[model samples]
Target: MEGKNSQLQQRKDDALPRGTGNLCQWYVDQAENATLRDVEGNSWIDFAGGIAVLNTGHRHPRIVQAITDQLAKFTHTAFQVTPYESYVALAERINKRVPIAGKAKTAFFTTGAEAVENAVKVARAATRRHGIITFGNAFHGRTFMTMAMTGKVAPYKRDFGPMPASVFHARYPNGVTGISTDDALASLHDIFTQDIAPQDVAAIVLEPVQGEGGFHIAPPDFLQRLRALADQHGILLIADEVQSGFARTGKLFAMEHFAVKPDLITMAKSLAGGMPLSAVSGRAEIMDAPGPGGLGGTYAGNPLSIAAAHAVLDVIDEEQLCERALQLGAQLTELLHSARTTYAAITDVRALGSMVAVEFADAQTATQLQQQAMQRGLLLLTCGPQGNVIRFLYPLTIPDAQFRQALDILGSLLNQPRS
Candidate 1:
């Protein structure tokens, strides 16, 4: 059966289009902590951390055990039909820890896109507005509405045709490319003046630290200003922490770095310690705006995922992985900085906790670096609008020895002359 499955995957690839974007040449046979063994029996350190979904590392013992225990009792009981304590308990825990000031509530979903969609529903329902403002280079999701909200076009939005209306894009504050907080605010003002009135907007959804948009960190001032603008215009402020949540940015949520409070926050990625779960937590008044029947899904808060989420939360708190993120981030930034001196093609080195990134001269160079690293048994991911950025998302629970080994491999790869 295993051989048949492998053959099926090989055949499937031949039938699949190149547009789908293939990462590795072989299948992942097993993974533990921050290491993955390919079908060929070669192991590679997982610096990508499953795109920030393995904060507790792959197959974390607690999460695995929790899922196993839940399987013994029951697996699915659709919360809306036969409510479960795990779902309610997980939601309550998230509500209490979401970094909000006032009363907060949480709703669960299966993916980050669903959480974002629900957040939009809550905002539009509460404000009775039609328009939403997202930033340039933003990546919300692949769903029809989120695709409309996303600012980038190329592979994600091309040919999708006539996206949802009333969604506008403003410049995000990026110091490297010269976009400033003032510039971002100016764009927002322009949107109100030219695109839609402030009162007509339902929400301004943003990433505290953008994921697919080259790992740009939204300046504290910019976030504070946006918060004030939302308050002034009665627009809901939604922080999409799908990638930056669960200690990815050395905080429970990236918004904790700033004083601003968002009316809604969408989180997924590492929320379940590698299980499939996403959530929307926000001001109770705003979240409750949707009718009781207007929210939820059959597989939204699956029992197994909920159990894993509870274990993930407990592991994070008990292990103090947040502090570990800071320590690891600093170490990685320092190492990358040293390597930059030797690699002229390497330009920028920036990090927020373990969410670090390095930009090359161009996409071709980034691709070459990634290929070369993979040859040497290291795995990495490329980001940025131009695909010139290499983002590191190593799990916080990765042992120092393995983490350092991955860094050594990366350092050697960076020192090699670019083609």
Candidate 2:
């Protein structure tokens, strides 16, 4: 008989579409905290954290209990069709935490893409403008408007166009590529002079830390300038914290690190501790720009997700995951920095709290490191347009001993002779 792993792989090949990229070959049998077990009985340490969706760890009891409790009562009522208190309660919870000033409101959606799209929709309605701005190498989402807003070309926006109009891109400062903040700001000015004028712009959307753009941390002055420019012109500033929010950055929200505030914020991924939930919380006036029956989905803020989100917030407070993220990030950043001496190929290691990444010389070097990391039983993921950056999104709930073990394994791979 064929081995169970092989059998499952064959079935997966026959059943699923190739478009749904499977990074790991084996299916997970069970997971708890940072440990994952495959159906074939092999154990692996999780470092990807389900693409930054499990900051509280996989299957936290609080979340499970909350989800279970809500399941027994009811699953979906389509909040717009028959509103629920859980949705309002969760919004209130987020309202108190968002970095926005003054009164704020929140709207829920099912995925990060929906939150992004809705944010832009509200921005357009509020500003009554057709133009939006984004940054090169930044990732918003995969939907039509977001895809247009995204700056990457291949894989994400390759034949999907003709993309939506009035979505412009400014250069995001990347030290690795020698782009300075001055260069980035100059590019924005160029966009105004060369493309859409600033008056026609509705909002400028960016990831506080560019998640899919290789874990680039936005500089404080960059954000401040954006805020000032948004005020100078009549535009909204949107912080896409979908992958970097909810204590991932050693803070409740990564934008909290910056001195400036965004008019709107879109969050998801870890917002519900792995539950499928996304939300847009912003200024009350802007969030209310869309008229009644304008901004909701059939399963938006499903009761189960709302309940799980409430438990997630409670767990974040009880477990102090924000402090844990800082502790973990310091350790990982130090290891990555030290490993640079062992491996000359590593160009840089950077982190903002637990959102850490190490960049290699090229895509092949990074890909080799990823495969070798797996051989050592540590799951890793690559990011960036060149795919030369290895991002570490290990759950903050990972045990110290286990996390150190994973780090050592990675150091061994990085120390290997250049491929």
Where is model 1 poorest over a 10-residue stretch in terms of lDDT?
A: 1-10
| Model 1, span 126-203: residue lDDT tens | 999989999999999999999998878988999888999999999999977999999999999999999899999999
Candidate 1 at residue 121, lDDT?
Answer: 94
lDDT of 1: 0.90
Per-model tally of clashing residue pairs: 0, 0
The list of candidate 1 runs beyond 4 A from truth reads: 1-9, 14-19, 416-419
Model 1 / residue 379 / CA error / Å: 0.6
TM-score for all models, in order of appearance: 0.96, 0.98
Candidate 2's displacement at residue 214, Å, is: 0.3
Over the stretch 348-380, how does candidate 2's per-residue lDDT look in tens digits?
887999999999999999998898888788999
Candidate 2 has an lDDT of 0.91
